[model samples]
Target: MSVTESKAKTSVKTSKKNVKPAEAAALKEALEAAQIELVPLSALIKSPLNVRTIPYPVESVRELAESIETIGLIQNLVVHTLPEGMSGVAAGGRRLAALQLLLTENRIDAGYQVIVKRVSDELAVVASMVENNQRVAMHPAEQIAGFRKLSEQGKSPAQIGDQLGYGSRHVQRMLKLAHLAPEILELLANNTLDVEQCQALSLESDQARQVQVYEQVKAAYSTVSAHLIKRVITETEISVTHPRFVFIGRETYEAAGGVVREDLFSQEENDGTADRVLVDRLVMEKLETAALAIELNEDWSWSIGRENPLQNYGEDRENYLLLPVPEPQYTPDEQQRLDELYATQAATETYEDEAAIQVLIDEIESQAAHRQWTDEQKASCGVVACLHNGELCILRGIQKKVKTPGEADAATQATSRDLHVIDRKEPDAAEGISLPLLKKCLPNAHWLFRLPWYNSHRKQWP
Candidate 1:
């Protein structure tokens, strides 16, 4: 109107030029590859996807939101619509979490526009599994168990490979451990063995030989890894069963900390005892200090510590380091891997998969080139995940930068309604023993042989 009071003309202004063409093209390609389309969060209110499948680290999303506060949601998730309308999260739960943070801060509109990719139904599921396997960092036990469940549910290695975007060999390796003998499995369950170690055991043609090696290695119980054991087995051409003894000597001092009482125990002491002295399981908790709890299979394994040889050593309990049966110390060698993958936690459902993942990664990265791969590479050029439910439960491919199958828009969406909490209760004691757990409604039950947790390194000392 000011252009000319009499002419009524308007001026057309243009934005500055000279933008980065490559950056623009890259952004467009990324958005397209990720299958991003504009949509609203209300549409994703009740996604059918279980977050378990798409696990990630909370820290990652927090970092992303921090970036978003300065920048913006650079990309979006891929989703599909139900019969009614555009709805549900398909893949990219982590991405959604990042965007939500911005909305919560009022930095973005409550119902702002969001871009998403329309992933296929099959891709949706595959993406979810990838998120968990790689990002969530699936536990060794869970990986084996999940594969077994899939197989039991009529899925084969090839099928699992196809669904989870794993190579047939990769799936086969995991399946190999899943089919180990019960003894081998028992060691794994008890944190005495790992998957590669189990895989190494599988190489033995003779089942008896495998068991012998297992027992011997377990007996020696050093931190030597499964791969090292494999090398030794192949190089030495020796029987897998190599006997290792538990040799621990404690020096008792009489005044001035001088050595007085010294005893060396043989392997036989692991399970046998000289006499029957009732052990009242007690939690010797020191104020301001770490509480002491004795668990046979936990710290001082009863299999090696129930000898009761040290009980009658002295009347002054203060001057003596009173130990329950075994002293709960692993030989320096095997102690290194006591916290390895598949190692069960004392009071948690979580499992560590670091070593197991390391093993699997070594196998996957050494493959041939120029092959048509079924899986696509990961989003951030590799993996990005979170710790959920107290553990890294996801098992996705980071090195391969690969994406799994079974992806599509999630039809249902869910937010964490509540956090998981471990219920702590005092052990019910009976007959000087507090039952760690009551079986068959027996509130008072004491177990045999105990190893105190104070010296928890190896904690399986004999």
Candidate 2:
């Protein structure tokens, strides 16, 4: 037998033994006296005695209408007779509004009959209060389970939302939560994990990963935040905004079979990629290709690519001389165009326009500042192409050979002596000068010691 049938039979058997004859008779009478009638849609009106005086949200009314359209009304409106052949809905004000909405939309005619339980004026207020107050909302876990069941039944999220009066995105989120680790779901059911924490955990598709993060969070802090959970979950993954990821761009990375997962709970445009190794490989390959192109096109001796050459080379970077490239002289037409751009930039009132104009000016100047090495420099030097702030950075005319020990030693000794002399004079100078100001002046004092007047008076110092 069906569970409902079995339960019904059990209820009948229990009532037969427990219910008194007089009590049964009274219930039968009460059911008969309660007047249920089919009232026309045009005759229904909101009663002033309704306990819900606050206006229903527009979305609530719309959702109610959608529910009614899907399965028709499930509950009868409790209403009372009015003075002019109309009925005032004392209990179901929102229901009456939803019916009116349907009528206004031409989905239902004004003459359509509505099921209403007619109540006396004296009992109307009580009925309205009872209907509004005497209800329990379903738990979130139960709602999620129901949504999952519907999804298993081949119902799309949009279809389920239309039938149940929920937004599609809300249904989608609940569906995602339903797929979380069993342990996490149990915690959610028991009120240990909240909706937000569950949402964060759902970002990881693997149940093992979700459980691992949850246990780590539980061990670390007494109170776990959604942000903390997400951070822990995505710590090993590369962020979409990472320099290499941004340089590659989303479309290209996806085309290369790199998967990106978007963080729905994040306030900003945050996303993560699982393929960190692939991204690094692609970045290096692209950088090397760019370096090769620059070497061939510019007639340089050689070129190499490094992610961050400065950090990689460390103190050795000092041995290479970075040749300064002068900006090219603008032609007459180029000069006139630049003058017009400057005037437009000055006249622009909005910050956005000013920023755009500045970008244009910078681009033009960058093109003009292209490095042109002499034939001798090209044969002896090479270029280093590296990444800086998600963009390609080219260090041109970097000396290929290291400096001689004699030259390096002489430079270091001069620097050390200059610093030592400044340190010695600082104590006496501190008596009259602010320490910060004196410290700032000391770095520039190396040039001061080379002055003829200062050298002539050097013997006067203590």
Candidate 3:
């Protein structure tokens, strides 16, 4: 029987927070709520009056399905039942979707029992709106605290995760957040610090160090992201994946008493199944020391190992721009090798085979090794190390300016140079010019030629 025609009727228990004052009062007198019923999966239908408008993320829906599979549905679906074999979901659309996913996966049968609360059409929209919009989401800090409490009650991360329907790793990460300084947690609650920043902060186990790093960034900038926080905290460290480290060789670096810091969480690049070293400050220094030897051989009067902001801008900005580095020229043999590498790469690309692709990769590496800087270019240029796209980029042979007589002021020269660099023919004038107008500029071009427009419109003897 339809919910409207059923003999059973119960008054809805409404909370002030879940329902509006008018909705609560109106529902109290005008509508009758029904008790929960176990209906077949095929009998229920999604409500057109459902209040959820935003599409849920696919990942979230998938996780919900996992949760449902792990520990059956905890909540009942609300539906408005009609007499003509039509039923619409009034609330719990997400749960319904989860159930549907289970059915498609053959995890559940067509006649699988679904707990549903049948309501009348009159209260459908309001019931959906209340269920979706009224329930507030818990703050992240509170969630972390709850997880920590569960851990304190002698539950392992895996056990807690199983009960909560979350991954063990996620549960452990949440528990870690509960250890953050209360001040930092308060900032997170206030929405001043985001989840990423908190995660970065959690990297430092020492509470004092976290606060110190936080203050350092806060004092320097108005706002900070997780990347900025990590940059400040790991200022001395360098990724082992850095090209400079590979060039120096790990054995030579370790012989020089350099240490490599490995991340316990991340895996190896080759197999992606084994743990590997992540970063090293000592090894980075050893690599820099090796680079310094190269710097000495170049014989610059004076040079800094790193890029100096003062040297790149302000009083030195003009000098930096007025002088340009000479482009490296390759010898004939080098050019031939490069051409061979390009041909090999092209051949490998044409035949989509793995072995050919591997050979192409090796040839490209050889091509890079063959190219060398000219002696004169190296003599005049000094090397500077700078981070480019988060990797060490060694800039060789950057020239120093020699003052020239009768030169324009730096600002004016810079503006003129900027305009020259961006110079291009604008499309507006070129696109509008007609063939007749274009021909007018040519020698003896005026009456010798008639355009189609002129020839077609002119009066002719017939």
Tens digit of lDDT per residue, candidate 3, span 275-347? 1233244334543664476577755433444422224444554544322322235567755764665455444
Better of 1 and 3 by lDDT: 3
> In candidate 2, which residue ranges exceed 4 Å CA deviation?
1-135, 268-270, 273-275, 309-316, 404-462
CA-only RMSD, every prediction: 34.2, 18.7, 21.8
Highest-TM-score candidate = 2
lDDT (0-100) at residue 415 of candidate 1? 11
- Number of backbone collisions per candidate: 57, 0, 1
- Where model 3 places Cα greater than 4 Å from the true spot, the runs are 1-135, 190-192, 224-227, 244-462
lDDT of 1 at 421: 17
Question: Alpha carbon lDDT of residue 133, candidate 1?
Answer: 47
Stronger candidate by TM-score (1 vs 3): 3
Residue-level lDDT tens digits of model 1 in 148-185: 65666567777766555555555665676666676766
Error of 3 at 65 (Å): 37
- Candidates 2 and 3 compared: the better one by lDDT is 2
lDDT of 2 at 75: 88
